[model samples]
Target: MSKGISGGCKCGAVRYRGELSDISSFRCYCRDCQQLTGTGHSEMFPLVAETFQLEGPSREYQMAGGSGQPTWSSFCSTCGSPLTRRSERMEHCLYVHASSLDEPEKHKPSRILYADAAQPWDKPNLDE
Candidate 1:
């Protein structure tokens, strides 16, 4: 059996597990990500939606994406730790915040999204 990736929220109110997807992990610098993470960008890793499992108290916040599609941010209702991001544009996969992973060091972002929207102080290392 394949080992599942697992992690949870800060307050232990939310947890999730899933099998990794073929989609490459990426860093998003969009305004929504910045505001959600309270930083310049967000690191995301993808998991197969069909294999994703989430438990405990969580809430979702929806907003219009840069693509003008509805996007949702799921987080722990107790600790408010951002957990995942979902969008109408890509429903086949679940994008998890890399920092929310049990092994965040395993996250390797291969690409950058919304680089043009990236802040000056947090310039993306495009050469990666």
Candidate 2:
């Protein structure tokens, strides 16, 4: 198993610790992510739904997603920083922003998703 990883909400109000899953991470250029983050693309770090544990209750907001469905977004109510995103489909697994992890640097992007939605000006630095 890989070394354990940790991280928390932006306001430091909530925290999490767990074994880093072997799942691959990616940069998403979907409209949902671009609008939520005000960027051309957003980062995703997916893992087994049960591998993560939240130390505190998270504040969430449901908004109209790109698919014209209700999407759930959570954050630290105090810090107002993005934390996680959940699909309207109850069966789908949850997705957490890799940046919200306690150790963001520990993550490495494996690829890009929703390339069809990529912005014209958001040239990514492949070296970063």
Candidate 3:
């Protein structure tokens, strides 16, 4: 059986619940991802947009992605926890941050994106 994902912001101001099928998860090493996540890469599961839902208010920011399409990042304004991301490049999908999920421990990225942009000191052990 597939696991369901449900979570909220650090302050419980933004809640979401969803089920992802045909899973295609990855970690992005683009500079924008690094700056937004404050880490080497941003781990996300790209799910069908229709499968995701959000409750409560969130602040959204948009910028061009590596694909040169507008990408939106939404987060809770109250606690500043990153929530969801969507890109015009993948119109049918929503990229959910693994760190925002209640079952974060279960998240396993299957691939890495923008590998050439990766930081020298931070790299995922692909062997695992």
- How do all models score by TM-score? 0.94, 0.76, 0.91
Per-residue lDDT of 31 in model 1: 89
Displacement of residue 109 (Cα, Å) in model 1 is 0.4
Q: Would you list the clashing residue pairs of candidate 2?
A: 7-102
User: lDDT for model 3, on a 0 to 1 scale?
Assistant: 0.83
Better of 2 and 3 by TM-score: 3
Which lDDT tens digits does candidate 3 get at residues 67-100?
7889999989888888888888777878888888
Candidate 2 local Cα displacement, residue 19, angstroms? 3.7
**Which pairs clash in the backbone of model 1?**
none
Query: Native-vs-model 2 lDDT?
Result: 0.72
Q: Model 1, residue 109: what's the lDDT?
A: 91
lDDT of 2 by residue, 6-106 (tens): 67776688886656446567888888788777778888766545666777767878887766788787777677667777766532345678888877877
Residue 24 in model 2: lDDT: 68
Model 3 residue runs over 4 Å out of place are: 1-3
lDDT of 1: 0.91
Best by lDDT: 1
Answer with 1 or 2, whichever has the higher lDDT. Answer: 1
Arrange candidates, best lDDT first. 1, 3, 2
Kindly indicate the candidate among 1 and 2 with the higher TM-score: 1
